[model samples]
Target: MQSNDGPAIDETSSSSSSSSSSSSSSFSSFSSSSVTVTITKLTTNKRKSMLTVNGYEFHFKDYNKAKTIKFLRCASRNCGILLHKSFSDEFVRFSGKMTDHSHLPNTAALGIRTLREKLRQRAEHERLPLQEIAEQEVRAGLLTGHNLLHNRRKLMPPLPQSCDFNIPDEYRKDYLNRDRLLLHDSYDPQFQLHESVYKRPEGRTLVWSSDVQLKLLFDSEKLYMDGTFCTAPPNFNQVYIIQVIHHETFKLYLFH
Candidate 1:
């Protein structure tokens, strides 16, 4: 949990943000000064907030509630007009639309956003894994199918870009940081990285090696390897092999 700016996303939580193709809605009429937009929590990245105003979904993409500076957009793919807003002393106000958008606001994408937010919240607060969450969302009629959901712990796309996928911003969240091992070894830099990607088995292997493990590998006469197929990365069903050796004194060593 990090709170200087906002809480960090759960390390295991994959970004499930995507656009909807079949839904549509339009902003009827909004007066920048007359209406106060309420920013509500969503399953979106911590920086963003989602609101449904008169059937249209408005996504506040880059918001600093403390500083009163924010950027907004309609969630619809066809009409994603970026908007601006600022607040001070409890007063909320939005500027006229900034980027190009539909003459009518599309609500289908907002519905998708809302659904995604709900799915993300389920993954977070309910303490459920991505498989459960993805299945539940589809069971609830949110998604059809996405291979990314099956491997939540690895190979996640970067968080949705509020600006654009090609152009990244400071606000964009980077999703893959799976090495809990790094945190424990950060204070000491003795760990050496030996990573190899395999094609035949269709997976990758990573090893954090130290000098003491090398001496064990060289000193032992009989070497052994223990492989398990029940657990692995990216695919989760591949085989992972660990090198092992028995020392002269009958001590066992493992390098994986």
Candidate 2:
């Protein structure tokens, strides 16, 4: 009888210990899951600039989670100025106008409506049917073709000077005599100046390349060049020439 009684007491103690351990573990899990941090606004003694525009004063407020402080403007319609609470503390004490509580149309209200309309238009445009795009594209192409033909005829009028067959001897002579120096001295001086400047800088070198070389290399790599601009010379009215050399084959390519 005494041995049986000892075993029963031991079993009861073990059950109580296990239950206490389980309850502690459950409480710890609950405590961790329920834990949350709340941020509250705190008043600071720092004074900031307050702008009073139209009849309203705006104030800057300190927020705990914000990187930069936010400004709170007066809710008055006529006065849209921002007031600093620290700076406006004295003003608020005497002026009954501090809390006028009037609803005036401010810049914020104006901008809010405009932004909403813009967003709505953007959403509507995004939802447009593909058929509308196809129709617009077709119309644009037809209009562009018509404008091009009309401009070409107007620009290229029938005149003695307009004919490409006629070449003036004076113009030809002027072209040949324009480059009497044979080589451009400006190129060497500019290159030498840049090289000298870069030599003093660590891990730097002065390099120059033309658009033609850039285009050729891009094409060889199956890439395309974009954002190209073409301008005609005053007298010649022709595109500028660009030259490129192939890296592997050493072949020259010219583009205009």
Candidate 3:
């Protein structure tokens, strides 16, 4: 004999899904050709999962799939839009939020927000040059080249701008004109800075190869560097030497 009774299926569980179609069709057009959008963080707090997807910001609403299925709600108190995003194997899809925005988006706000978000996204321990990032924007055509320095400053944190109340206007002008050299100066025309290394500070640590045996300099391995106080000339108390051995011939070439 068999029982006719069956396990009850909770209607509430089934109602959780908003779509009636298969999951494939539901996610196929998440970021379709018509959508030109970017996801940016709305806050710095890690626990408070607030993000702006294509200019529309939303706050965390729920957690699923080990907290990967991020369900979010519009941050604006007046707005009731909900957002759906998933990450398993790859991005499943993003949906639920309306793309229309109420306020007019200005260039200054967008520029500052993008820069700040970029700096925040980078690992806190990594060496990043904020000023250099600003300059690169001009080269990349994100900002105009005519007012290069002013545009660069806009991209960087305006610490100097707030603190430079006592600084002479002329000094600020000088910074605008030549400060680009501080992070990017090389006496040797042959050796150029890597494009990735757009920013560095003004300091004595920066150096380069110079002089005889220089021909073999680029061709060598096992480069050696040492400084001697005892053997240096009177005018030069400390003399540093860099020597390298040829890769093929195994000949040592010394350069001071």
Candidate 4:
């Protein structure tokens, strides 16, 4: 009877220990699920990628290429939250701990950031005029002021520093049709330029007019000449504009 009673006591103690261990394991899993981090990807003003978690934004601080992980830090000032994101699989997975934020999230700033990103993306891919695009975005965002948010020069070619730079072949012709827009290029003889409109050797003058415009100028009975001194290029004293009057409507059109 003593031996049977001892076996029963040992069995009860073992079951209790097993139950405690299972409860601990379940609690651990529940805690992990409760604080599961969800990451939201976004773009910075410079079009760089960033992530947001729990209304806080994080930017990349470092990268671990071999481990396929990205280390990020809170964008807010003095915020100590750090994140480790794993990119080894098809989806991004979050790791490590994040502390409580020092201040509340600024939803206005976040909205502005999102607005700027949208403006930049529209500027990049769309063929619509910039003014039209900006107006549409401004109305959609309910933003004030007429200032454009995106960089205007993003799609434009870099301006040449000096007159000695080479002109690209595409720029030499009209964009609508492949017609010669550059009538003369004195510096570069390879262009097979026309004779200079002004014969002065010291103050060399360049003129641009299509063949059709020249024909119209010759056919018109009345011609108008206007010269602008203030708007001329730095090297020139004045810019002369020749105009022709339409026969039927009497409207003036630029001839040169």
Best by lDDT: 4
At residue 205, give the lDDT of candidate 2: 26
Better of 2 and 3 by lDDT: 3
For residue 123, model 3's alpha carbon misses the true position, in angstroms, by 9.2
Give lDDT per model, in order. 0.43, 0.32, 0.43, 0.54
**Residue pair clashes in candidate 3:** none
Model 2 root mean square deviation, Cα atoms: 29.7
Number of clashes recorded per candidate? 7, 13, 0, 0
Cα-based TM-score, every candidate: 0.28, 0.17, 0.29, 0.38
Model 3: per-residue Cα lDDT over 1-256, one tens digit each: 1112212211111112121110110112234234434565444333233455555545555655455555665555566455445542122233433544343333454345555545454434446685666455445546466678887778754443221123233332222232222221233333456658744333212233333356677656567777888985443346666777654554434423
Output the lDDT of residue 95, model 1: 36
lDDT of 2: 0.32
Candidate 1, residues 24-143, lDDT tens digits: the string is 222234334445434433333443334444444555456554444555556665664544444421223333333333444444555676566666667668877888887887777644
lDDT of 1: 0.43
On TM-score, the leading prediction is 4
Error of 2 at 180 (Å): 13
User: Model 1, poorest ten-residue lDDT window?
Assistant: 178-187
lDDT score at residue 194, model 2, on the 0-100 scale: 59
